[model samples]
Target: MIVSGVILLALVAVGGYGLLSGTDSEMAPVHRDPAPSSTASPRPETPSRPQVPRILPTSNPETFARRVAAALFTWDTGAGLMPLDYTSAILDVGDPSGTEQAGLAADIATYLPSREAWVQLRQYATTQYLTIDNIAVPDAWSEAVAQAQPGQLPPGAIAYTIDGVRHRDGIWNDVPQVLTAPVAFTVFLACPPDGDPCYLLRLSQLGSPLR
Candidate 1:
């Protein structure tokens, strides 16, 4: 009987050991979620600004005029003072703000930093060195008569604005007007064979009239 009891106790101890081992094995395993990885791509940043059209603004008239004058000087005078597609004429009366096409620079309220006439000589043989192509010597300019008839505006007639015009000599001719400052006008090729749009530019100096 003692031997049988000892054998039963040994069997019970073996069973308890088995149970503890199973429990330890289950608890030993570590649990964790997979490491996170970024899936989104980096986005580029843009400037936050109020976009406006970059153009010749009418709000600032002075700035606009100055810009135009500078451009004309470079276009016309920069070509070695060569007689270009247009001719330079005198208006006689000094008017800086005048929009007349044919005019004098001195008579105008302002002149460029320096304007000097350069006489060029052309030679084909031993003698005739001067030619009209080299430099233009003025002969005479005929007075341009008005093609349009002169008349006052009818009663209640709508009128178009003449920005710098002091007086209308006639329907087609304008009289000389004085400007408070100096300005510039550019002569352009009026019409072309290719049928491109053409226009003349008028530029007003920033400051003039010594005031």
Candidate 2:
């Protein structure tokens, strides 16, 4: 009886092995990434903004004062002096057309104050006081000249805030003869940072009247 029991158990074990072997064979496969990643920190991208004009520096303070005096050809700060034609109805208030290439032009000489104590140009930021023609700035540039404190005013100073289009070739000159393109504008000027009281003059409004 014992021998018969042992034979039966061995037969059952053999049958179980045959059943699993008959089943479909299978194996788990591993996959690797095509490229490896670095553990180093990542870099950031820069922001894009509008461009501005590049005006040269006055070198020193005295050089600036001399240039403005020479350009207008007058030592008298009391008079209405500006750049442009000495004659012609178009230039009576001074030549706004004298400035050129809003993108590559400058009047560093006109803007910087020589006598910081007398002119008190320090009232405004150094960057503000030294910019000649901020033409590259398509948008309107603010004038803190109007908001200056007393004792800062000189005898005759004027602030021209220009806001207009840069025609195909009109960045520098406002006249059509120099430039064929018609860049329309409505720029205006206000009184000085130092001397005069609040006086306003539109570029178009002043010259035609004086003429």
Candidate 3:
């Protein structure tokens, strides 16, 4: 599941992704400042909370991609689950070769709030979910594939740009509150043509997906 330099360049041309560092990849995750935290009692895990999948099982690339998108954006801060717990779920369905794990972790970090932010959100019982508007193969991807060197891309590698709305809910000062915003991004995946399950590769920068 190694991406060649040529394909990396093509992806850059199509999607405005930042240079990936730390693991010798081609895209980097956005960094955010850490928020200060206050000492507080630990929250209790709800007994009725539904179990989240670690490894999502699906051979269909589109289905896998949609699921991955949802998993990345959905979470409940008051469920006694930390950001890493949600991150683990997405990583479980990531590149099995572990080549892109570090990069993916960095990508996930940008989407999720920091530990201090999470704690503060918990006080308000903040929860978030994505309402997907559409998912399609970006036309620019065809150009990237056409220019890629032989065997440069992984088996069944594909890119899908997702358009969606993010909805955040919380109880603020004893009042229920909701916020919504539009979000878009591209998801790179490999679903071997032999019918093997799909695996997430890399993600484009948030809101800068290929057309």
Candidate 4:
């Protein structure tokens, strides 16, 4: 199915730190460096390990979608959560298998920054809001499923649109600033033949707003 021109509104909190402001078309993911700090202190002797977010697995697609969206958009530099840790947390929630897991790892490697960068910047997402507009199967996925073995095919596939706002405190002034954008992605779900359970099969970005 062609999922276009569909829209929805959802207001989600970012672990009680920030608020989502508007509804509109998809935007590119935003990455901004924190302004230079006026008061600089010696770097910590020992960097703390990142605290990964809790993963609450669920069979419901919509709920899982929301979780994935939030995980992809949120981060905490102050708490020592690095980009790799963030990626690991997201993977834990999805529980992908085999090649899917490998693909996710590769994607994370390509997109996430190095540990040194995280340590130097100390900038992380304070808040994020994801507005899931539509869920539908893409034609290419449908055809692929049709040609595949019954059990090999994903139970469901959906393309969803989400808008988000990432917040961070300005480095020099200590003022808060927000980076707003929208994103779209296609997700594939793996469901058991029996009455077992469901998990994320694969996720791929469809489009994003221009920076």
lDDT of 3 by residue, 106-201 (tens): 777777877767766777777788999999999988888787777667889999999998988877656777778889888889999899899988
lDDT of 4: 0.46
Estimate every model's Cα lDDT from 0 to 1. 0.21, 0.23, 0.75, 0.46
Better of 2 and 3 by lDDT: 3
Instruction: Give the alpha carbon lDDT tens digit for every residue of 150-187 in model 2.
Output: 52322232333222222111111222221121122212
TM-score of every model?
Answer: 0.19, 0.18, 0.78, 0.58
lDDT of 4 by residue, 1-211 (tens): 1111120101111111122222112122444445457576434344335467754666565566667666665555555456678888767745344535655555444334456555544543233335555544444544454555544444453333334433333232344555554455544455444534456544453342111
Q: Output the worst ten-in-a-row residue range by lDDT, candidate 2.
A: 14-23
What does candidate 2 score in Cα RMSD to the true structure? 39.4
- The runs of at least 3 residues in candidate 3 whose Cα sits more than 4 Å from the true structure, single-residue gaps closed, are 1-51
Better of 2 and 3 by TM-score: 3
Alpha-carbon runs more than 4 Å astray in model 2: 1-46, 54-190, 193-201, 205-210
By TM-score, the candidates rank as 3, 4, 1, 2
Q: Which stretches of candidate 4 lie above 4 Å from their native place?
A: 1-50, 94-97, 109-117, 123-141, 147-151, 154-172, 193-195, 206-211
**What is the C-alpha local distance difference test score of candidate 3?**
0.75
